[model samples]
Target: MLDAALKQQLQTYLERVVQPIEIVASLDDSAKAREMQELLQEIAPLTSKITLTERRDDNERKPSFAITRPGTDISVRFAGIPLGHEFTSLVLALLQVGGHPIKLDAPVIEQIRNLDGAFEFEVFMSLSCHNCPEVVQALNTMSIINPRIKITSIDGGVFKDEAEARQVLAVPMLFMNGEYFSQGRASVEEILAKLDTAGGARKAEELSTKEPFDVLIVGGGPAGAAAAIYAARKGIRTGVVSDRFGGQVLDTLAIENFVSMKETEGPRFAIALEEHVKHYEVDIMNTQRGAKLVPGKLIEVHTESGAVLKSKSVILATGARWREINVPGEKEYRNHGVAYCPHCDGPLFKGKRVAVVGGGNSGVEAAIDLAGIVKHVTLIEYAGELRADAILQKKLYSLPNVKVITSAQTTEVHGDGKIVNGLSYKDRSSGDTHKLELEGVFVQIGLVPNTEWLKGAVDLSRYGEIEVDVRGQTSVPGVFAAGDVTTVPFKQIVIAVGEGAKASLSAFDYLVRSSVEEKELAPTTAAA
Candidate 1:
């Protein structure tokens, strides 16, 4: 049945576009076909008149639309539901009718054209995940470039049963035919390779693949890889599931103090941890997300688009996102001159003038770090004084190239559309405005915890950080938290890693105690 609101929306669209296109439904019921035809006529009145055509043969049925207008060449043919990447098909059909080619990057276009044959793709997605949007866009782009790819998208909440049956735990899963291809957000090149491999892999081998984890971790960041190592070494089955294989650690440039290691980069430290964890034969499901979390004594963990992993417990090592400077043009010049992590994007501004915003310890530390690399470092603080420790403040003051501008706030960001050239700021005390020309701006403003999903799952501090005890036990029993998401004072990578280890150990001990208590009550239940 057509809803009244949808019928009204169709009418509005028809009035706005003032373009008429033919529509035909292939359903066997004559009344249903007539209803659909009437709905389109009400929505797109300017197009060629809608007509109901009866299907003579079920096998030969095809929904066709022909657009014959001045300066427009359009044709649409549909054999199945337009879902997943099929959303692109709908857009392309519109473009073809409109007689305009949608421009796309050459690399992405080339990847799509390389597909061997008609491939079926089923993607289960959640609207909440950050990277899922990118996956959907890429899939749509591929469909626009080529018509050989069949795509379907299923909303995780709406199609819970089907998703569970397919074992879709994470989003942006690409299922080629009936086989799972790849999961999570994939780049165009990566997806093309997965499609190629999916075509050649044996069905029996895919079904028989074994996972090595009682607890599978989906990130290689300090929390994830550390959890895997801890659980496996303690004689519990464990595995690491990750997308980049190195996690965010790969992006970190210099880690001056991670406790034991005096100096380390994010990539090197992650590699070492991976190696340490691998020595215990803990399976590493590289390039995957914990797609599904099935509840039971032995919980099942699903990957981006692959098999379910059976585990007794699960931990989220997925960390926080760096805060963005919301000033105009900041996003436009992210990699060019504006950045979030001084450790990741600082060196690129070497020997150039730079500014760091915020008065927290991270902000002060970032300014100090940039001072060593860039010709001049400007520390902009909205507060009256620096919030960093006295020691760090003294060190920052000692740096000759560093200038501390207290009670100053960045009001606007100016860029040449390619790189940030200058910025305007306001002095809180004098109400004076001044502009400074700089090559780079590092936003060392604090990070926001990625805890939007934990709506009521755990207790959070006033700052939205998870409230965990010293032992890392959260308000919830089976659920534990660590790292930046927790209410830990210092937001250092080393501190986060240490907390992750502690949290895992605590969770492990709790699991053992639970098992013994359950066993102790078993005999009494049998007697009853």
Candidate 2:
């Protein structure tokens, strides 16, 4: 059901419609389909220029909506219910169909217009994926401008077979011309670059091999960006190599713990970070992933694209990623009913039963959060007792909708070929197996650092995290690490920012000391 405030907002957004737009919804005898129909019906009457036509189609595999304008012969299709973060995509699609011009950079628009051959983009996504709407919107905007580009948004939950066949283990899995393009959150520039390379129309750029930079940041997350900004302020040549500018922050939903901000979403915060970095004179190399690290007098960073970057000092801010729970059906039902982020994917499971695997701080926190949204939550832990803090455990136990199970080892994830329906676990003490029925499973075990490339290049801890001292200096001189990739006790954004500042200052000190030593070692010139 649509809330009054949200209905008012949709009404306001629909005011931009210049002509009557028709939405043709094909529904089947399913609860999801009925829910989709109800959602459309609730919003259609808010705007006079919008019309909805529903038809019973048993052949329809899922609830599908086709959007068309008065004179447009081509119809854009959305093959799933758009809710949560994806609701914005539906609104934007409607506005674009209603004659609202898409706002994009001139060069980007030109590139889309000049694209050769027909490109069909099938974006598989989940309703709760915070990063999916941007991908959908970018392709939709391109489809509006270029007739050769066609966009189809598919819900991974409803089309599990297709998703599994494509090996879609992540959200925002894009298929361009039936080939896998990318996964996770990607910027428009990154998408365009990929398309250019795939089409064999990519133009090579000559990189300068002159004097190496004073400092090179290896990631584009908060820590790396902060280090770059600090280094640039010292009037030094700085460079940043990043596969995507925002890093894992792009997948984050709401960031309230960030200092000085009451509340901010991930995408908006990422844009702000990029904009802040652009204010400095740092050379930003986007879409470049570090493949290997070669440390020496001049550090060489080998990118996956086969380009080598040299710098005097390097800062590794490559963040950590969520650890995967290697259980049966986990991979097949990743976006369907198995998720990682509670902040991002929690709302989609509203009023539905879900399970959280782990009893640590993250797991307990997730349980407490999901209990507020979902109908019920079952928290399972392999340890005999909850490892979460006392306060967190207290809060978690106070929730009436939560049930905690200790010493339970999850063995297999069960699904009905469409979405996760249940899971099987074994009691560690009794060695007995048990099964629980739930619609979603949230894995919050731990994180694995993204420092595998630096294995031989720098010193690493037993857990593979980059070893750094209090000054953010690694074992190797002139090399520093920060953020989630380092040995910092806390992995919050604010703490990463502080660590980045420290690492940048340390690098600068090392440069200063090296310059003094070089001057002192130089032969004294005769006073002639």
Candidate 3:
């Protein structure tokens, strides 16, 4: 299954294995099984440490393999072809299981080693989902750390019937033991926080004890990462706190507009950005949400976990998220048939009918993408005409399995208590109600800025976007905002990056002009 270049790369990576490992496969006489066998055979020769074996009697899940050391009870399994976005996850599992040292913090490794109880985690994920690899890789790493933990990354794309039976309409759906744990993207820290009951309070207490930063950037999106790099380069104390480092960027499918780079994936871009920032001496606290902001001499950013982080100057770079339709049954049926990411959850609705709400670029793109996957795609738009670009609209209309309805409003999502059965809409022109009998509803109504948390702390626009001046400075002194959360004209990654740099520079200027410490440290001569 691997190409010549890939074989060389795999061999090089396998050279890091310090211990022998085993691949115990549970498979049947199926095409996927044969493909997996071929993949395993090709990989085994790359490293002599790998010992491959098979079982005649398989478990409930077939076409799967487990990675483990000879004497270790720990396991990391893949229930399908772990290629596509999950290829990295497969590589990481092999390396870690073969005794290659993980590059995690010493404290986190220690915590995992000392973790209590047995955890059997099953993650239903799609190979096309860029977000699933992170969750799967995180669980796999944890499984290697603690022998009591076991992680199985299941491919919903291959096991469509099983996904439908479990009512898993979203990719990266998690199940602990046998009960549903969560849906959507998650990091190792987030997963650990949920597994341990008192982890939040303990983390809060630990974070609260840190010394104040000269520049504290909240949120770890592209904008926050840029701000961090700029501030850290100035030889000042810099720190960043975010619930998720990638933000909406992780949900993004592909980026063709980013300058220099012709085309790239969002998850890859976000990782490179994070890694670039890490090259500096900046402190990054991931999986921590800043709930409230206090504007003062030493601005305090209070986290949802009750952690109080103070800084001389603050930069708000929290990005945006998919806006919900908020119609009836929308909330109740979320992940049960309603989804936001077309790329991640599109395969789940294969051979079924689905409706994409909204008429703009995202909506049209979703309808076009789903038309090839689902049986039929009904595109509903609130406006009189589609706001998508001319080419996209043309392409959308050319699809045979796609239908576009303009001047229609989504009234309610219809579900039979378990999963979505259909949807209700209203025609603006005819003043009539319409219902679409479908299995899934994909909401693509654009984005809402993640600025609700800063409501009372800063001056926000009517749409809840932080009001920033030309310098990216907010209403409050020593507090700046950037990216989608601010009043930026265009919401692009490049623009966010520039705004972030501007915000960091503005914050540094404010700190030097007001603080006695900064004044003493400031250079006496003018710019050369």
Candidate 4:
């Protein structure tokens, strides 16, 4: 199941174990079971601290294993061969069970330890889902911290029957105590906030008491991180407040256009960006969203938790999110059968028919990617022709399971009140409506800026993008905007970084001028 190089790496990582661990397998006669057995046998010998045991139980999910400490009730189970995107999850679980230190804040660990009730987290995941590992690692950590928490990560591909029975069309669908908890990407902070009712009030009180910052950045995308670094470099009191540090970049799958690096994944890049910012003196406030901006001598950025954070200068880098079709049944069936990211949710639709909406590169790329995993793919473009690059279009057309329909407008998503069964569309040329029966619909129209909160506070373009000068300054003084939220032409990561740096420099220049003017006015007032 693992290559020689991978085994070497595993052995090196296993050396960090401080306590003995046990791997208890529950399997039946199957190829995946044999693979799981082989993997367990291979891993146990690398370190004497590890042991493997096997058992068969008809009631339990086959081809599964549990990692536990010898003396405790810690049970972190995997109901499938957790590899691909989940390989790191498997490694983390092993290290955590073996008494390796976990990467979590002390306060969060305490909160988990103090939880009042038991939680059984059954996370349905896919091997190809880029967003699944975070949830798995987080819940596993929580389970480790508090034995009352039990985690079972089930691979959706390996347990298709149960997934379908539960009508789970999305990856990382979390269920706690047999009830639906959440779906899609959920951070540990967000999870705790939901679990603990008073967490928001406490967090708000904590944020409201902080001193004013010289440069406060909103959003934690490429622009926000770059701006924070630049501002902190100037020996100013810099801070970054955001709900999610990675912003829209976390949802991205592939990045081949980023200069200096030929290839990189989104999650890894986001982590590197965060690590780079932490190396500076910037105070980071994660899992906090800037709700309203009140411009004044010291601009006040209000948060959802009713915290009023005052700052000398504010930089808005709140990035954009995936655009929706605004059609009926789209929202009702979201996560049920409607998904925004094909890269994250495509594997769940294996051997099932799905449709991709849009004609641009993202749409065509999604169709191409889905063609390989799904039974068939129908690419519906609203325009007369697909706008993807020539090479991409050629590749998409070459796929046998893919079909393209041009000049078709998506009208309504049809579902059976549980999951999507088909969709309705109209032909632009003939004015004839048609429907495509499928199990999933991937919306790849485009992106909309995350600027709904900025309306009436700052000058917004017709499309709702924050309007800013070349210096990245908005209509309001000391307030700057950048990245996908601004009026910038191109929304590339490189552009966002440059804009953030420019905004920070321009803000510092503004601060210097304001100080000089204030000093000049003081003498005038004295003479008066």
Candidate 5:
């Protein structure tokens, strides 16, 4: 199953293995087991330092792999087949088990090593989820450094019962010590911060309240990071608060229109964004969610951790998220069969028929991408015609396995108790109801901005996006907005970056004018 290019890449990565590593596959007599076995067999021959062993176990709920090395009793376990992006997790685990040094900062390593008590992390993931592997790899690396930590990667598809029991509606759903930790892609530092808070260390929370900033940026996506960099360059104190740095970009698999970069994956591009911000003096507060924004002469930003950040100016970059269709069974069957990100969940529906909702650029693009992965794809759009670009529409129609239906509204998401089996729709032209037998439904209607926290604090559009002028200035003074969360006409990476720069510059200008006014208004001393 390993392609020649991928095989060569893995072989090169595995060359750093200093010691022999053993991959023990615990399998049952199932098709998934056979597939896992074939995958391991193909991988084992590529490198002489790695070995694979299979053990038949009928009691096992799903195929599992235990990786270990000689002289080490530790067994790093993965609870599902590591295909798609999870393949990177498997390779990284092998490298760590083979004694490769953990690539983390000294302070971060210290924090991980200082973690008290045993913590078990069970990350529910799907193979196709582009963001899942990073979290899995970070946990695995932490486990290697701190033996007290145990990490398990659960494939949501194989462990459907477990996922449903936990109400796992999203990929990369992390559970720390049997409690909900976080969802979506999280950085290693962010995970450690969560651990610190869970353990009642109070370090992360304590550090957050230490100082006020000239500019406090909420949301660490492209927009927020750009603003931070621009503000920090002026030698002013700048800070940023984000639940996760990458935001919606983490769910994207491939990005080609980011300007200058021909192509890049979500995770890789996110790292670059974070790295760029780190080069400046910006105070980055990761894994922190903005709870409320209070604008005044000095804006006050409250975080979920109860940290109150005071700043002269504030920039809102809390990017938008995929808008839900809100039909019946949509919420219940989220991870079961209904998914929003085709790049993140496409592999799970391989050889199965699926439906793509919405006729916009995202929907048509998803259809084009899924057509190659799945047996058949039905593109459903509420508009009379697809709103996608001509090039995209042409590419989509070129696929033989895709069927496009316009002027159709998604009425209900139908599914079995455990998984989605099909969906019901209404033909807008004829007013006729129809049902499509599809195992999966990908909703790509559009994005809803993350501006609920800004309610009543700043001017917001009817759709909840922050209303900003051309200069990225919000209605309220000292408050700015950018990215998909703002009133920007276009929601692209390059556009967001430019908006961020404009917001920061405009904020600086405001400060300079305010400072001059304050100085001029001061009481004058009479000469003696």
Candidate 6:
């Protein structure tokens, strides 16, 4: 239960008076509902709160509240304790409820209004892909502006069948009324134009005027982008397909030691890297997901938008995703206070208390880095001792703000409204239970390669990593794998980039050799 003082503070915070805010609490207890009611009443004369019991019949959906206030036309729904990006969504919803239009300029608005009839659009996304958020936000905004657009956004791995059915080979795909539209970041104007063309009553296939690409690389991370840069530099027709423009690099919090650069954050570093890649002849489809891989003498990539890309060679650079603990609230708190990447989400919790789960090198490093930024860092280890190197362990323990708790396992995360407040854990040493108060939790358990879809098509390690030779060649002759997903000892950004470049070169060589072999075989038959 919240104390009266805290309730008064929340009430005052609610009364800023310009916009209305509503919090939909999904709780089972009636006593908690009463507490919320009392809290709302104290928020001055402006705010109006509606309970979930009053609106819905069932409890499985949890009780949510709609908040409205005087002089505001917008109604915001605070769904199940908003945190992380959800917190940002909550604020926007409140602003919207207060009649604040998240204005898209005339051109964007015009295109949206002109979209005809009902359309179902599905976009595949990856959290690790930096560009996924932008695509999601754009589509979400479009949905809010136009009701005709029904957007179904699914996680790529989670919705494998849907992806395979549509032949999705990458992330952030935009599927138009049952047909593939376009991949990558289509501007508001471009989408409108494409939609208009597809929705026209007459059904005639219009040949695209865009020049054909020499090499169409799938995935973005370090591998794909590096391939794009190298291929473009080599004067090969190169284009990149990715749901997120930045790939795995964006999730890194701080990269103090990526070769060539002194220090950089993951997102900023990726932005710069992306810009450099685009400086060449590379055309990047940053928002499109790969829908299918068409096999032949030459590889053809069919995207979600039905844009068939015929390439002499294709490079598979789709990276890995973070593995979850399966603990309660793990999914709910993702991208909120609970995070998978220390590089991307660490700064958000600066000067605040936080926890780091896992005792591996990644976890130890993350805790040490976070200790420098946050007020304190609590290291939770499920094992009896740290799994990191001795030097790293020493460095981690040396930090004044860092505390290593061995043989501890997180049982559940506890939070209310905004961000993560704390978590409950079990002390393995004593089998004692204890609750901890923390502002954020960084998960560094490990990653699962994004290769499950490539079963039988490629050689994968027992650990699920793509099995690659010294030359980055997979079991398949023409195909190659790189980055963390490959059986590369190191999962560093520089290594991934290097492997990607090597793989691209290998693919190029394979294409050349295959062409030569075909030519040789043809001449003997003709001569005979």
Write down the RMSD of all candidates, one decimal each. Answer: 20.1, 5.0, 3.5, 1.5, 3.9, 13.0
Judging by TM-score against the true structure, name the best candidate. Answer: 4
Across 1-528, the per-residue lDDT of candidate 6 in tens digits comes to: 346775565445444435434443444455534544444444333355322224335552333344444443223333233333333333444444444565666745766866768876765554334444445455555655665665545444434455545555344456777786665444444456566765321211121224555567788888888877877877777878776766766666568888778997676777787878979977776445566665555666655555666666677788887778788877776554777655444544657799999999889998987888789999999999999999999999888999888899899987775457898899988999998998788888888887765776677889888899988887766667778888899788899889989988887777678778888878454555
As a whole number from 0 to 100, the lDDT of residue 345 in candidate 5 is 74
The pairs that clash in candidate 2 are: none
Better of 1 and 5 by lDDT: 5
Alpha-carbon runs more than 4 Å astray in model 2: 1-114, 124-128, 154-170, 173-183, 198-211, 327-337, 343-353, 368-376, 389-395, 398-401, 412-424, 431-440, 523-528
Q: How close is candidate 5 to the true structure, as a TM-score?
A: 0.85
Summing lDDT over every window of 10 consecutive residues in candidate 3, give the lowest-scoring window: 54-63
Q: Which ranges in model 6 have alpha carbons more than 4 Å from their true place?
A: 1-214, 302-308, 341-353, 368-376, 388-395, 398-401, 414-422, 426-439, 523-528
- What are the TM-scores, per candidate, against the unseen true structure? 0.55, 0.78, 0.96, 0.98, 0.85, 0.58
Which rank order by TM-score, best down to worst? 4, 3, 5, 2, 6, 1
338-421 in candidate 1: lDDT tens per residue? 766665345445577988988788898888877887899989998899999898999999999988899997888788766688
Pairwise TM-score winner, candidates 1 and 6: 6
- Candidate 3 structure quality by residue, lDDT tens digits, 1-528: 799999999999999999999998888988998898899988988889999998759664788999889986967899999999899999999999988889889878777887889889999999889899989998999988897888889999777788888989998999999899999999888898888758778889999999999999999999999999999999999999999997888889889998999999999999999999999999999888889999887899999989999999999999998999998899999999999999999988889999999998989999999999999999999999999999999999899999889999999999999999999999999999989899999999978998878888899999889999999988998999999898788789999999999999998988877877767878898788
User: Native-vs-model 3 lDDT?
Assistant: 0.91
Model 4 segments beyond 4 Å from truth?
A: 524-528
Clashes of each: 13, 0, 0, 0, 0, 23
Return the candidate ranking by lDDT, descending.
Answer: 4, 3, 5, 2, 6, 1
CA-lDDT, candidates in order: 0.62, 0.84, 0.91, 0.91, 0.85, 0.65
Name the lDDT of candidate 4: 0.91
